[model samples]
Target: MHALVGDAVRKACSELFSVELAEGQLQLQKTRKEFEGDITVVVFPLTKLSKLSPEATGEALGKFLTEQVAHVSKFNVVKGFLNLSMSAEFWKGFFAAALKQDDFGFASPNSAPHVMVEYSSPNTNKPLHLGHLRNNFLGYSVSEILKAVGHRVTKVQIINDRGIHICKSMVAWKNYGNGETPESSGLKGDKLVGKYYVEFDKAHKAQMKALIKQGMTEEQAAQQTAIMQEAQEMLRLWEARDEATIELWTKMNGWVYDGFASTYKSMGVDFDKLYYESNTYINGKEEVEKGLAAGAFFQKEDGSIWIDLTDEGLDQKALLRKDGTAMYITQDIGTAILRFRDFPDLAYQIYTVGNEQEYHFKVLFMILKKLGFEKADQCYHLSYGMVELPEGKMKSREGTVVDADDLMEEMATVAQEVSAEQGKLEGLPEAERNQLFHIIGTAALKYFLLRVDPKKNMLFDPKESIDFNGNTGPSVQYTYVRTQAIQRRYAEAHPGFNPKEANSEGHTLSTAESEVVAKMYEWPAVLRMAATTYNPADIAHYSYDLAKLYNAFYQDHQIVKETDEQARNFRLALTYKTGVVIREAMRLLGISMPDRM
Candidate 1:
């Protein structure tokens, strides 16, 4: 609806005023607090073209706009700015259309190319942490936004289920676990395995200290050699298909998978495919050999294979270690090859990783291009900055890392407490209360993480972020509930008045309600921008703005007690449509709306 008005204004300016406006020149921007209008237009850019004073230009343009733009019912000139007030009839049409459409703000069928998003690459040695939660939420929300914008989206996850760290866990388990299972330990697989990992680190450090006290050089002490030996023994057992060791590994990994599945379910994340390192690690070794044969890769005397990417502004990347085992980059290359073969027409491959690995992805993509993968240039590193606490960085070694499950439980507990304290759970059953906590908890976490730009490091201020008061998830959820409450009351009071009935009388535009409706109409543009930029935070910010506008409109305007029947019904219909749009927008950010605060 806003687009229609902008188009009409632009056409009038171009054809009637002899001014060639830019595509987005006549944007429906928000007015300042002291301003009388809801949407403001800056006519400063048109002053030169009009060859007149700024105020004169604004006045002339405003007059032309009101006369020519059918959707815009009124306009006011404020110095060099033009504020547009859209017609109520136009809003009624827009609201009715929005209500009739199943997909509120989705793009047309023929819009854009396919994009692949990869996220949540958790290591096998440990379960997910607070950092992984942010990555997962951003990736999932962006994928959903892209799909809504008519882009074919492939959501993928690469499991970092192999490495020395994984081997360390295996070593600890083999030597000290005594064939104990996760069921026997009564712990999640990742937690059970993570415990032994900490144990190994402690023992390994003690052994190193002992070796150093004996006056041996760090390398000569063979401290690392002992750890590697233990790891190698376990790897040998695993490769030989030792039934006892395999059984334990499989059981522990299964428990971890179960834990991860539950977390994903609560967080509302899903993937089209899951790529495992164990399956893809060997694929690139053959590709490396081919690259070596083609002279694209070089081998050292000790047999380590590498690609020199310095010519492409990247450091040399190790393709295979001297021991011929696949490294992290090796598996990623193989996965890319396999994915390309699986989906030949994939236009973009996005890797949602941390900013610390920026150099790694840069090198990885350069190597792929060097190896003659033409589509390698299309790969993108969606490097989100780290999530630090208010104090500083979260260091796992210092035990400051927040576990994903524990964080969710904490948020849920807080939600429950706030609900009870506010006495909002009066009529909600116990089961319903529990469900609301889950929804509110997930929303708080997701909204807190997604409200900031992905490229900048965000400080998770525990006290401020988890608060149910102003500018948080709970606030937005409360606004939604309040709107729903009003609608429910109105429906009960006027049993014969159907919300779905199309109004022939047309709406009468109020200054405040028009502003709210205009903001609501901009949802499609916001979704499109976020999708194109791969920034889910844009949607988060946009939803917050919409909720704020709705809250202001609800507080100052009486929707249920309007005197005019046509005006009352029209306003109720507007509120109903706004509620739907807001709910859909929140869902795209993986947020749930409660019917009551």
Candidate 2:
């Protein structure tokens, strides 16, 4: 309807005003609540072409649209704006067509070029945390949104499995673990590893305090700490493939990987492939040497390879260290090029890293472009802001970060509490009830993390997220369940009822029904915007608004109880379609909706 009205206004300009509508000249918006039309056309831009006052231009366009556009039933001019209301036939026709479309508001699968999304690139030193939660959810949701809009998406992550961070965990465990494995400790492997990482920090800090008291500077003390030296030596040993070091590294990394798989399952996110810095850094070294040979990078006297990008508004960045070792950026470069090589048809890749790495990616892309990668310009950095709890930002070294597993469990517990208070799951079996709680809890966590703009730092409140009255996940889930409940009641009342069999042409939609249809009508546009921006928050808010509109419509309208079969079936169709859209939109956010929640 928006497109139809915009075209009508353009035609009116060409025919009635003798002007071609150029790009961005035709402006259409939803009419304000007090207006008498479904869409409002801004008349100010058209006034220049019409050679008349805004009011006169609007009046002329309104009259012309009504006469020529079939869906433009009537129009009114208020001040300088033209408000056009669509015909009832137009609204009902779309509703009927939408009901028959199994892929309504979604593009055909794989209609777009292949794209890869890299997210949740966690270091093996620790378990996943609140920050990892946001990263994984955002990346997964963006991948899903792109898929919905016809993109062939590849989900991947480059695990920081080999680093000084992981070495710290290994060193602490070796020195102080007493051979305590995850099984012996009855803890998750990643959690057990994370404990040693924290232990390393504590021991290192205590050593720093003692050294500072012994007439040493803080920096000297930091480097001289025994635990820090142990981690550094462990890293060197692992690099040399020392048998004992390699054995411990493999065993500990195995534990962390097992723990990660479990957490990812509970969080409902998955990857199609995994990349490791241990392997990619080798590729990065080869690439850096090639860049140097091609004059894209230069080597310093100390044997470090660096890319000079001062002309590109970025300073020189090191690709290889003075000791000829790969830096963090080096592995990133390898990972990016490796993905393009792995997926030959990939149009580009999106890196879902935090906002702090904005400069890093800029330099990386610039270097790639300089290195003559044709698709370098097509790459994207989906940088998001840090997530903070009410208590504040998390720190992994201090072990104050909110563990992802513990937080997920807390959310489910909160869901159980909220459901018990409402008495919504009274009759369910224990297993089924538990499933509902998981669904509801996971939805709340994902929705709250995703509802805000991706670039904005957000503070999460667990209690607020579970509230059913506000713009929370539970509220949207409740509305979807309500739609299902309405259909169930209708099905029981009329055992053979089918919304498809009803003749909707005979039904006149009430104002409430019209509003619901209007909200649903915006789904396609909302979905397109989300795909373009790579933001799941767009889909998140759209689901909430659609759910809100449907709940409002259901409050005063009768479906199964209506005397008119045409009206009853029409309302039932509305109910059915609302549930479909809500379910689909939430699914893109990597959230599941329970039927009875």
Candidate 3:
């Protein structure tokens, strides 16, 4: 519809003013609600070509559009805006075309550029928590959106495998566990590792407090703590590949991977490939050496390597420590280089990370460019704010973070309770009921996290997220179920009724039906905007708004018992397509809709 109207408007300019339509002149948007039109074209920019007032330019364009464009049935000039109402024939024609096709608003697979999205990059020392939930959902949804728009997207994550944090867990587990293992303790491996990480912090704090009481300064006590010293020594040993330390590191990291797989499975997110810091840092070290040799970086007297980025308005950043160990940024540099080398056709590499790391990514990209990687400018940081619970902030080192696995289960339990109270799953068997509960539960969880713009800090409330009456996943699911019910009744009553049989030409649509069709017409545009911006919140809102529109139309009109065949079939087709779009939109958000519920 936009293409047809856009071309006509341009043609009108060429014919009327004998001037080419400039790039920014023809701006079209959804007509404001108070206006009686489908779409509005801003005429203020066109006044330059028309040599008339804004209102006069709008009048001329609106007059040309109504006569020249078949879909533009009638139009009005509201000051500088030309509001055009599309004809019923055009909408009905669109409905017929839409009915004949599936995958209506999506582009063909791999038709666009190749891209890579990196997310959920957790360290080996701790289990994933609520913060990881937001990261995983955002990354996964963005990848899905890119795919929907025809981009070949590779989803990946880099595991923070070698670090002092991992050493802390190893030291604590070795000293506290007299050979106790995850199997022996019957705990998830990541949780067990996290428990030990907390233990290391506790013991380090206690030792520091004891030393401080003995007249040492705070900094002196921190460095003198016995457990801290052990962890530091263990980190050095791991870096040197000492057999005992390497064995412990590999075993514990393996445990964490197992635990992470289970959590990711429950969360419905996955990676195409996993990059390990242990491996990538080796590459990063080599790159740093090459950079130092090439004078892109400098080596300090202490043997630490650094990049001077003050000219770029950032301070000098350390690439490697004095001990010649790779810093966090060093590993990132290696990963970026490795990925482009691995996927040579890559158009972009997006890092889905927290807003707190915005400056870190800026430096990383600047450093990548300085290293002479031509594609370094294509790197993007999909920075997002934090997700907090109603209580307060959580601390992973203090053992106060909400575990992802436990939170997912709690959401499922909440779904089950809500379902039972509403009698939503009465006829289903136990197994089916359990599966439905999971779908509804995870839908609630993902929707709540995704519906907010990624740049905003959001408070997540499980109770609010599960409501079927609100602008939520389950509400959209319920609307989908209603669509299915209409089709089922039609199927049951007429035996082989095809709604498309009545897809022939009709009266210019009544006001109610046109409003619904107008919203549907906006789907492709919404998809394009969402894909370009890499935001799932746009799709989330589209689904909710679509569901609301369908519900409003359903309440105001009769579908199964309308005496008019054309109207009934039109309404049925409308309901059916609405369901299709609602399902697809929610699917991109990683939310599943059940047929019955």
Residue 536 displacement in candidate 1 (angstroms)? 1.8
TM-score for each candidate, following the candidate numbering? 0.91, 0.97, 0.95
What lDDT does each candidate get? 0.80, 0.89, 0.88
Off by more than 4 A, model 3: 14-19, 48-51, 390-392, 397-400, 461-466, 500-504
lDDT of 3 by residue, 502-564 (tens): 653554466777778888888998999999998999999999998888888888898899878
Question: Which numbered prediction scores highest in lDDT against the true structure?
Answer: 2
User: How well is each residue in 1-597 modelled by candidate 1, as lDDT tens digits?
Assistant: 456656766776777568778765555676675766556778887777777887887777778877876766777888888887666677656766776676777986537787799999898888789999999999998888888899888999998876667768878777788977777888877788888788778777777778889788888665454776787677667646689767766766676788788878878899999998878877877778888999999999999998887777667778998977778889888988888888887887899999999988888888788789888888999999999997799877788888898899889999998888878787988898888998898888899899889999998865564877776777788778877888899879777766667463655676677667777777888988898788888887877888888887877777789877777877787778777877888888889898875
Error of 1 at 255 (Å): 2.6
The true-versus-predicted C-alpha distance at residue 550 of model 3, in Å, is: 0.6
Clashing pairs in 3: none
Q: Candidates 2 and 3: which is better by TM-score? A: 2
* lDDT of model 2 at position 69: 80
Q: How accurate is candidate 1 locally (lDDT)?
A: 0.80
List of clashing residue pairs for candidate 2: none
